[model samples]
Target: MGKLGGEMKALAKHCGGSHKTVNDCIHIVQRFDHHLLALNVHIQRVAQIKVRHIESYIHERLAQGIGKRTLQNEMASLRAVLQQAGRKQVAEHEWLTNKSLGLAGASRSGTRQAITPEHYHHVLETARMKDPGLAAALELARLMGLRSQEAVQSVQWIWGMGTGVGGMWRRCMGKFDSWLRASSGWSRLPPFTVSERLGGGGKYQAALPSPLQSKPESDRTNVEINERTCPE
Candidate 1:
């Protein structure tokens, strides 16, 4: 870790929360510190943080097109850090509030659209042309409803299965094959059911039904073969 990271980590130790929450607070504060550094404001400690600094940070982020929801979360994290530093007045200052910063209420409305088959195929082909390994990883992420890091880690887990690692690969693939046989179509399949017991630290467990599952056995075999043969 760099100087800013170390400082943020020390400040985060004063915070009270779960491990993830503390780490998240540290990350946000580190970002703020980096931003201050960029602006030629050398704030080496949290005690140096002022309402003006936060207001300036907010305005800079807003100008950079940061979303209201994200800004709200950032402000909350900063507030926690500031409060821990015994700067309650500065933390609760009106100028630092979301409303005062012109940050609207965060919305929970779902706006994501599922990837269409045509688009998926097009991107897959393009990725294949660039790198077969990347194409395979992309397929794994899509079929398993995994984030990029999860897909990579899952592949590693699969390779390490017989070495007393775990059975996540076998279980996920078995569930995927079963879902393939039972589902009518893959154009609008339900979201994958995440198993919290099996998935620690927000990693997904079960594989979801995907359009590739609707393909012929030969095509499915090709994907599996690609996954196995692709260079790590």
Candidate 2:
């Protein structure tokens, strides 16, 4: 760890939360520290952080086109660290309020759009040529409707379990069993638990059809063939 990392780790010991929460807090704070360095403000310790630092960092992020919800999260992390550093009055500063920062209203609506089949396959094929591991991860994300991070973590988890590509495909098929049944006109389907290791806090039951059910048969078949041919 570098000097800043060591300082953050020590500061994290004072933040009361679960291991994951503390790590996440430190991650955001570290990102802010990067912004500080980029702006030529080189404060070495958490205790040295100031309200001016926070203001400058937020302005920099806004100029870089960061969204309001994300800035809100960064501010929350900074506030926690500042409070721990005996700067609790910073939280009451009028200029640091949500309204002053332009983060007070309801969150903007999501702009996510569905990826067309042609576009998805085109990208997947390119990834395969460059890196098979990336291709496998992309395939898993498509079939399981996972976010990119969750897909990569799932792949790592599979490797940790001593199961390679073949095992991953088998697991995918098992999860889709309920969807296949639902598509074949079944009235009911079984529930499956999403593992806590996949980024969420704990296991939860998902009793719906796999997102793959909405996809065409050709897309599903192509993925199956690719997985089978993928090297172990």
Candidate 3:
């Protein structure tokens, strides 16, 4: 396909199947187009995009305050839509899918300041004194490194037992510990964690449905009762 033709087709698919408005589609597609242009790629050949291209696109979008999950969803939707257009290869090579392009937000290289040991300890201790949810959340955030909403949404029912607080806590802590290195204040770095920004929602919790148990060491992803991996 010619340059204009490819743009037209991608735009058509994006508008009809994407956000449902030409205006929004234009913005999204234009952003996509701009990124491709910067990378010296064309719309028709977007299916040939590699993980590096996706990293650039994600870094651009993440700069706009789009949440990591939301960005993941957008990319996922885009990938599916592209696949329907026989462009699944584009999605397959994305940073999200391939885990290349080690971008960082609020990390050692990000613009945001890393949380200090004192601050981390403070949040943990304060939560311990006041709210168990807050305390559990702190462990998830400061220790387990769960995103705010993940920690919040993690409150659900478990099998054979009761709820999924332990399930959530275990997962959160496991992730936090895995990346021993400090996160740049807000960099969209690799091995993304589930975290809500500080002072955002500021409060979330769930009661222990049963006796909370730490996830098995072997089960690193903390696959346990009530722990659902976010749909990709």
Candidate 4:
């Protein structure tokens, strides 16, 4: 590994997160290779990266048709590694601070688009027929309001916080999309079934955990008619 690659490894080691997260940060930093070279900022002197370099990079990326969210992730990764390497000042440059600039969909004067109930049911039913695992994952996300990462991963709903209060306690290793930042759309409430699946075959009584923040304002009006809706 060169200086930049070695610094990324150093960052991964110090960050001490899931392998995927660390690797993603490293990858994001690596994506700047061509631009960094053009700026004559080599891997060994990556810590010397400055705001101008970042601005130039942003312009280059934007010129090349990079999307807002992708750029956000790349900037985040760059900041993380630089900060981890004791170059916190460099990572917090004004140019890199604002999240809204050039970000598509960053302006939301209009209401967010919500998923329809009919569509939710159809999708769930179709997924169930096609793949039980996917259906179960969708159900977990819809009913419990678990993030995609939390749903697909192995989770242990251990009863510990309170005697009867049930909450998601543990999340094991798994990769799932979280950029959605909202529940998959359930515009109208879906049928509620108190099934054995919740209690783990009657081993533990399942108590509904706190509602997920992912629920959009439109979906919160009706409690009985639970609608699964994703706000995109």
- TM-scores of the candidates in the order shown: 0.58, 0.52, 0.32, 0.50
lDDT tens readout by residue for model 1, 1-232: 4465566668776787755567678888777887888888876676777789899988999999999988898898888777776889999997877889999767869789999989998999999899976786787767656557555555455433442223334434433333211111111122344444444654444433454435676643332212333222
The most accurate candidate by TM-score is 1
Candidate 3, run of 10 with poorest lDDT: 181-190
Name the lDDT value of residue 37 in candidate 4: 71
**Please, what are the lDDT tens digits per residue for candidate 3 over residues 73-121?**
4565555545556665555663466235333232233456878888877
Better of 1 and 2 by lDDT: 1
- Report, for every candidate in turn, its global Cα lDDT versus the true structure: 0.64, 0.61, 0.48, 0.56
Better of 2 and 3 by lDDT: 2
**What residue pairs clash in candidate 2, if any at all?**
none
Clashes of each: 0, 0, 23, 11
Give candidate 3's error at residue 208 in angstroms.
Answer: 49
Q: lDDT: which is higher, 1 or 4?
A: 1
lDDT digits (tens) for residues 1-232 of candidate 4: 4676566656755664555567676666666666687766674666666777777788788899986667876777777777778888878755576453455454435555658888988998999799977876777677656557656752333222322112212110011112222223222222332324443543432233323346575654443221133221
Model 1 RMSD vs true structure = 11.5
In order of lDDT, best first, we have 1, 2, 4, 3
Better of 2 and 3 by TM-score: 2
